[model samples]
Target: MFGPDKCRSTDKVHFILQHKNPKTGKFVDHHLKFAPSVPYDKLSHVYTAILKPGNELQILVDGEEKRKANFLSADYFEPAFIPPKTIPDPDDKKAEDWDERDKISDSDAVKPDDWDEDAPMEIEDAEACEAAPGCGEWKRPMKRNPEYKGKWHSPLIDNPNYKGIWKTQEIDNPDYFELDKPDFEPITAIGIEIWTMQDGILFDNILIASDEKMFAASASSDVLSDCQKKVFDVLYKVADIPFLEAYKNQIIGVIEKAEKQPILTIGVLVSIVVVVATAILRLLFGRKKPQVSCNVGETDAPGNSEENEKNDASAPHPRRSRRET
Candidate 1:
């Protein structure tokens, strides 16, 4: 099981075992026959039968790829210990195990048609995914709160401003409405910053159960697993790492200097100058605009049409038109 691959050959195979006679200083050959279906488990002492040129050989396991196999030579392999017979589980339980904690009907299985905010349901907040240093495989229940467990990882912490995480679940309140599922315990007091695909997690808000958390922590140790930590350091930062790590502290200073040296550095200065100049102009011209006012008795003057009528009566036109009565 330790080996990545297994091999099986059906043919009647023979292995040539060799030994040297100490008195004559000459080689001796011993032949060993391998039978089909004789598992590697049956082999008593695989290490004693070392194979060398013109000295020894062995029949390999049947039905295996010969990609890494060496027919001409064999390395000495030893077994640690033989295992006892496999035992079946007492519960006779498989992955399909189902239990009836509460009486409910399977006739019309109900699924949440859509997430309704008004119902006061699971409000997933914080993003589920952040830079999880070493998050592994993920799976969910086919039914709500199915029996399952596996390793998982939470996203790395980013903000120093925030305190430790808070965990919440819907509580068992008589006022809360239960779903169609049996003993459908509604989640109570969900983490105010919930985590779910509904909100499309872009943050590290997923908090696993204690048992699930233990699985992840046990699968790895220290800061990060060997495979997980390699990602941060293995990348090629030729200009920095190979020669500059020695003066890592100085590198930050160099970066700050470069950041400030942008040709666009004068943009802020220019913007400030413009704003100050405009403010000064507004202040200087504030009092110059005309201030209009009207006397207390003043009313709108008569229209020009009335003035035309008065002029018409006073000065007659040169036409023989009848005057107004």
Candidate 2:
């Protein structure tokens, strides 16, 4: 499945290999049937195929191997389809008179008087009935049929003749033969055959290796990171003009407001600073407001004049009354 309609194979990937069987003189298809479906999108993707010693082949997506199999075993045998271990014995057959169903409907059952087989399931509200005052109250109550027997079926039981999973004996494929080890051949290059509607698709980081460690080291290199950074830098520069303009307008608005009320702006800033400082002081040193203790008869505590001066300094200053000119 490639596209939304799946009518085209442009996005579809099918890994195929055509091998001429020397014994049979016919070309054999030793291909992977369940290749991972490629997604058609703007995001980049990586598909990799690794052929290692011992005829092991691995398919990777985005540097992670998703499928693996032994090509030797797969090509020489039917890897996709497996013979059933147990099959129903053809010699054992159900008799013509045998009834598999255990239950049947009771022929003597009769319909109840209140069944109301012809009654309507829902009726109009009595208030909405124009001709009759209580006309719409006549509705049939939906209920289960009294004489209905739920779907009849035979109860399951262990079979004496199960003869658990019968498997066909493995036989040598007369036409199958092994290719020379060197004939497997080293992969000198990788190729992509794409019939796409769009062009300019850049495929990068093509790696071919029999050793897993070598492939891992190459795939994990910083080349991709550097390329991604370069691409995103250009993209951000192209897309940032509107955002920068909007931010500039916001800063200008703030400056204009500050110009209109310089004193108010200063007061608000000072108040914010004071609040933040007070919170920090409380958090860091556990400072708290001092509770003033004054006796009922005493106007002021002894040696408290300096404390009163400090309180006066901390409180907001009252504006002095102006003298007449």
Worst 10 residues of 2 by lDDT: 1-10
Candidate 1 Cα outliers beyond 4 Å, as residue runs: 1-263, 300-325
TM-score of each: 0.13, 0.38
lDDT string, candidate 2, 1-325, tens digits: 1111112653334555555556676655555655656655544455666767776667665577666766655343343222223444545655555544444445555655555555544554444434544555555334544444444434455543344454344544555455653134344666665545664455555665556777666554412344444644443453345434434444344433333333234443444345445555666887666444433453545799889667756764333212112
lDDT of 1 by residue, 202-295 (tens): 2222222424334344322212234432422332232255433544454344333322332222343344345445555666775664332333
| Runs of candidate 2 exceeding 4 Å displacement | 1-13, 43-45, 73-192, 203-223, 226-239, 242-325
| lDDT at residue 323 of model 2 (Cα atoms) | 19
Say which candidate scores most in TM-score: 2
Candidate with the greatest lDDT versus the true structure: 2
